[model samples]
Target: MKIAELGADGTEQAYDAMRQLRPHLTSAGFVRLVNEVQRPQGYRLVASWDALSGRVVAAAGFRVQHMLAHGPVLQVDDLSTIPAARGQGHASRLLAWLEREARFLGCAQLHLTAGTHRYDAHRLYLRHGFAIRSFQLSRQL
Candidate 1:
């Protein structure tokens, strides 16, 4: 397996992967969002692909954003491994790649949110040196 940063040509693959995980996003909306993130001055989308089969097995995306407490932090918005490709260390490898990238970008810390029901993912994050920092609160508009 090889980890590659999704470039201009890799947008379609990244969109497909995200749509598979999040079916609610329409293709048009997803495309627009991808373009926004792929902008030269914005966030990055990194994916791990299987070299032999040419399939994207896992992905982790982050952006350097400012916060009151941390100043500049790497906010990981998405981390996903294809269902069929889980338990193969793809997620772990992608996370390792993200950590390196975060450090290289001079981020003060890495931050993310996991769903309350995703116990397995929570455990994985804990194993990776991420602690339960705080509860996420939100209200629908």
Candidate 2:
């Protein structure tokens, strides 16, 4: 397995990977979002690929920004391990890599949100040393 920063050439693969986990995000939307992130700006997308199979097994991304209270922070936006690739430590590897990258970027903290119903993911996050910082309230626009 190899972990790499996704470039423009990997947009289609990344979109397919995200769509496999999140079908609600349309292909066009995923492509557009990816293109926007690929710009020389604040966001980054990382992918874990199985070199032998040429398959993307896991992915995670983060947006770097400054917060008044937190100084520099990294907002972890998406973290997904392909259903068939779970239990293979792909998610953990991706997360560890992300953490290292965040540290390299001089981020003081990392934040993310998960649905309340995603208990398994919650457990994984806890195991990875993430605490429940606060509840997120959202009203559909």
Clashes of each: 0, 0
- Tens-place lDDT per residue, model 1, 1-141, is 889898656765665556645678886776667676445557678888877778887777678888899888888887877777778888788888888888998889988878898888888999999999789999999
Q: Put down candidate 2 lDDT per residue, 22-108, tens digits, no spaces.
A: 789887778777777544576677888876688887777678879898998888877887787777887788888888878998999
Cα RMSDs, all models: 1.9, 1.8
In terms of lDDT, the poorest run of 10 residues in model 1 is 12-21
In candidate 2, what residue range of length 10 has the lowest lDDT sum? Answer: 34-43
Which residue pairs come into collision in candidate 2? none
Give stretches of model 2 more than 4 Å off.
37-41
